[model samples]
Target: MSKEIKEKELIIIGGGPAGLTAAIYATRAKLNMLLLEDQILGGQVRNSYTIENYPGFKKVSGSELADLMQQQAEELGAEIDEFDMVERVDFSGDVKIVETNNYIYKTDTVIISTGATPRKLPIPNEEKFSGKGIHYCAVCDGAMYDGKIIGVVGGGNSALEEALFLTKFASKVYMIRRYDYFKGEKATIEEVMNHPKIEVLFNKDLVNVEGNNFMEKAIIKDSIDGTEEEMPMDAVFGFIGTEPKTDHFKGQIDLTDGKYIKTDESMRTNVKGVFAAGDVREKEFRQITTAVADGTIAALQAEKVIVERKKNQK
Candidate 1:
């Protein structure tokens, strides 16, 4: 059974850096705000091992940073509800409505910061060995493969960073990429190329994954030579890319071909009173700093929308 409908001045749909930042700003602006997170409060950041880019902290664990953000938001009077999965959203009326598993939320403004999720490699036995052996987060599973061999896929910054991190535990790491050249920053690329524990394999695609109870090996195809080889490894870490969690907003908001929400510079979506931020929105850059900036802009804009709406009613 569904719970009673609750009303608020603002509701943030995610609990990551973006949503938490939004909550902090919204509460400081004196807006009645509620944050909903279905899973862990940290979102994807929790899967991260270390974050050195976020200013103010020389080096902080992703989980620690997330906990700090949540703490600050709560201390500042932001109401956060974890494990509340949103069932649906309605933006047809003047007040945006969000229906979750337990409650229906009616809000003057809504900020969609439900960030992107890891894009899985569409290989045979991939889903079967998700937790068994095929892991997406190196931080969460890297220790399990101590003194073992593992394959790290993708040529992006995240993939490179995670592979480097895995080297601390894994005996040897195979860094695989579908492209000939690394797409990450020059410095990171150089580090990965020079790392003694890492072997860089370019123009390779993961075609199949095989395992018994857990992942044992993966099949890779050489795009350049059309040759196939079996890479023996304990586990494979896929960091190919990510897809935005915007399926719930279909027909409710404008989106790009990649399914990212379309928003203006103010982070306002096409739908009035609705805004998008973080990795969920279409933008060139996707980083913790960018997500925080998006949240701040969205919350301040949402404050404006709420104040204007109240004035209209008066």
Candidate 2:
């Protein structure tokens, strides 16, 4: 006999703020559902130093906010399976098939909230110094550089914000950018430019990193003058935006040119019972508030679909 299949009315394939919000709504609707996460309950949010734009609170640490969201979802009776990675998905049949490393789940509705991951530089030695000197999350690794010099790469909002946060631990923060200008909000840009600890390097790029075993210095080049310099740095943090995590749903789902999932206003995808939400979906904004809104819509639409199906069966 084939392996026994576990069935549910809905399966949410993420554990970020979007997925946790969906779980809260799904439990309130009394829908039989499960939320599967690849590793920890928190997603990229855990890497954030502080969240100020999420409302309710003026400021809160990213880890604290994530813990609160997870606790709320669990208290609502949401069945969450952390550390179960989704290897494949088949949405061809009426019942969506989701195969994880731990189990195979058959569901009438599927919500995709995988979110996005940080983008890395194009240096050959970047991967080699990943854990040694190069890092993606400033909050997770900033303390290691206390009273030391560090470098940050990127020109976007995230890069500028992280550079400012790194100042809490690092004595000096070198803001390296490929262009002379920054593309973040005016307020944030002003703050970064005015910060005493942050040194903005215009029209410059980080070519490579060097050290004995761990990284000790950064090779920076001037794009305009074609000059290079090796700057002593204790660590390097990269925050050059993100890439959508939609490789698994490539053929089965519709995606934008950037590989982000395409969803309607209600968070419903092209497939009948498949939905996409949060930063994984093609949207102009990818803030925590927007992710929560997307999750709410997806969860309500999923409940409606399941209810209509039961009515039709009767």
Model 1 poorest 10 in a row by lDDT? 41-50
| lDDT tens digits by residue: candidate 1, 156-204 | 8899999999999989999888888988888889999999999988898
- Report each candidate's C-alpha RMSD, comma-separated, in the order given: 1.2, 1.6
lDDT of 2 by residue, 1-314 (tens): 35457999999999999999999999999999999999787788888788888889799888999999999999989999998889999999889999987678999999999999998877889988998999998888889989999999999888988999999998999999989899888989999999999999999999999998999999999999999999999888988778999999999989999999998899999999999989999988888889989999999999999999999999
Q: Estimate each model's TM-score.
A: 0.97, 0.95
Q: List the residue pairs that clash in candidate 1.
A: none
What local lDDT score does residue 219 receive in model 1, on the 0 to 100 scale?
A: 92
Candidate 1 CA-lDDT value: 0.91
